[model samples]
Target: MIRVIVADDQPLVRSGLAMLLDAADDVEIVGEAADGQEAVTGAQQLQPDIVVMDVRMPVMDGVEATRRITADGFSRNPDAPVKVLVLTTYHVDHTVHEALRAGASGFLLKDTAPADLLAATRAVAAGDAWLQPAVARDLLAEFAARPDPRAPDAGLLARLTPREREVLVLVAQGRTNVEIAESLFVGEVTVKTHVGRIFMKLELRDRVHAVITAYEHGIVVPRKA
Candidate 1:
């Protein structure tokens, strides 16, 4: 089972998230926390697979807690890292970006459907970044609007082969592996291999980070509406 910790300042919201996730066959609520500091403490002790974190908790914000929880696992066991799935009432622009930058694995609005929430939890626990279409669009727009975006890591980009760079661009474009394979006239396994290489070479956490890198480095700009 995928162990999870629900963390939110509001009691009802915390209970609701816990109940919603615990009902899933593959998930179990191992713990709950009323604030970000408590959430970090619970995560360290319980070592859950996922943490459903609220963005604006007292004592410490979710972003800082997320940073602390994920920081320790950076050079440790990648397979067992405690992934965070951030939930918030705010629009998916600055908040989402900040969470991701702090090592959150997935993001969703608080009003997300129960089914999508479950799916995102599962996805994050299974080592994937989950960003719904709306979130992705808003994030991309936010990045595009930056008058001076952070420059891409020159040495890292230089490490990618021409083909890997193409794969990264497609990934940033929100293309699935199947679509990328079709577009490149390659097999799905080949596309997957390319993606894996790109991640390793760029040291990206997941596709979300890849998309951010692609945008920050001017690799793939948001398309004109």
Candidate 2:
């Protein structure tokens, strides 16, 4: 089963998520926390496969809690780190970037559809990152607007094979693995292999971080609307 801890300051929101997730056959709501500190504590104690965290909370915030939980490797088994999936009421631009930097596997708006929320939890638990397309677009745009003080890491790009770099660029462009395969005239398995190599070379946690790296390093620029 995919164990989960739902953390939100509001009781109703927490309970609602628990209720929705509990209905899933492969997911279980193992615990719940009302604040960020509690979320961190619960993660350390329960070691759920994933934590559905709220971005803003009293006592502590989700970003710090995520950093502590992920950076410290505070799961039941240190080798198997717990994943955090941030939940926010607003799509506050910086919060998304900060949460990822703090080691959250992914994030979703609180008003996300019930099915999508459940799917996102499963995705994070299975070691994949999830970001809404609109959120991804906004994040890329935000990164583009900022002035990057440091130059792109040429050494990192040099480490990737040419095909791997192509895969990374498509990923940053928000293409799915299947779409990438079609674009490259390769099988999905081939695309996955290329993506894996890119991640290994770039030291990225998931596609979200890969997208961020692409934008931060100017590998891919957001398209104009």
Candidate 3:
């Protein structure tokens, strides 16, 4: 079972999320918190597989809670750190970037479809990053507007083979492995291999990090809308 803790300042929001997730046979709502500090405490105590966090909260915020939970390795296994999936009503660009930087595995709008929420939670629990296409596009635009201060490590890009770099660019553009395979006229497995190599070479934690790296290094730019 995928254990989860739902955190939101509003009782209705927390309860609603719990109810939706509880209906899934493979998912269990292990706990709930009404604020960010409580969320962090709950994560440390429960050691859930994932935390469904709200971006804004009283007495702390989702970003800090996520950072503490992830940094402290609040999970059943230390090596496999706990995952956080941030949910917000607004599409505030800085909040999105901060949540990901604080180790959130995914970002979703609170109004996301029930099925999509379930899928996103499951994906994050399974060690994947999930960002809606619209969210990814917005994030890329935000990054383009205000580039990350840290300079891209040139050696990291130099380490990737040409195929891996191609894969990385496609991933930054939000193409799935299957889509990339189809576009490149290669098998999905080949795309996955290239993706894995790209992650290893770039020291990326997941696809979200890979996307950030791509933008940071100018491998991909936000396209004109």
Candidate 4:
């Protein structure tokens, strides 16, 4: 079973999320919290597989909570690692960047459909990244807004072969692994492995950071006609 902890300042939001998740047989609503601090405490106590976090919680807030959780899990090996999936109502571009930097595996609009929410939970729980297309666009805009020129990590990037470079470019373009596979006429597993190799070569924390690095390095840009 995939253990989950829900964190939101609003009690109703927490309860609603708990209800939706509890309905799934493979998912268990292990705990809930009204704020970020509580979320951290709950995570420590529950040792859940994933945290469905609200970005704008009272007290420490979701971003900080995520950072603390990830930092605590960091060692030679992360023990009972917790993956954070940030939830927010407003598409505030700046917050998305902060959340990614804070170590969230995914950014999700709170109004997301239940099916998508379930999918996000499964993806994060399964050690994969999830990016809502709308959220991805906001992240791209955040990357684009930076004043410095995008500079590729030339030394590290050269390590990737032609096919891996192609996959990274598509990833930077906000394409999901499945989408990249379809575009490249390859299996999804192949695309996933390529992404992993790219991350390892670049020393990236996760796909979110990879996307940020892609933009920072000029491997990808915000899509425009």
| TM-score of each prediction | 0.89, 0.88, 0.89, 0.85
What is the Cα-based TM-score of model 2? 0.88
lDDT of each: 0.83, 0.83, 0.84, 0.81
Which candidate leads in lDDT? 3
Q: What is the lDDT of residue 86 in candidate 2?
A: 93
What's the true lDDT of residue 73 in model 1? 59
Residue-wise C-alpha lDDT for candidate 1, range 1-225, written one tens digit per residue: 999999999999999989998998999999999999999999988888888999898999999999898886542466688889998887644766778788888799988899999989987776666876666776776765662244347788999999999999998887878899999999999998998888888877777678878887878887665
Q: After superposition, which runs of candidate 3 have C-alpha atoms over 4 Å from their true positions?
A: 72-79, 150-152, 185-187
Error of 2 at 214 (Å): 1.0
RMSD, each candidate, Å?
A: 2.4, 2.4, 2.2, 2.9
Residues 1-225, model 4: lDDT tens digits: 999999999888889999999899999999999999998898887788888999897888888998887775532247447889999898665676677777888878988999999999997887667878765765676676772333345798789899988888887765788899899999999998999898889877667667777776677777762
- After TM-score superposition, what is the CA distance of residue 157 in candidate 4 from its true location, in Å? 2.9
Model 4 weakest lDDT span, ten residues long: 144-153
Measure candidate 2: CA RMSD.
Answer: 2.4
Candidate 3: count of backbone clashes, pairs at least 3 residues apart or interchain = 0
Cα-lDDT of candidate 1: 0.83
Ten-residue segment with the worst summed lDDT in candidate 1?
Answer: 143-152
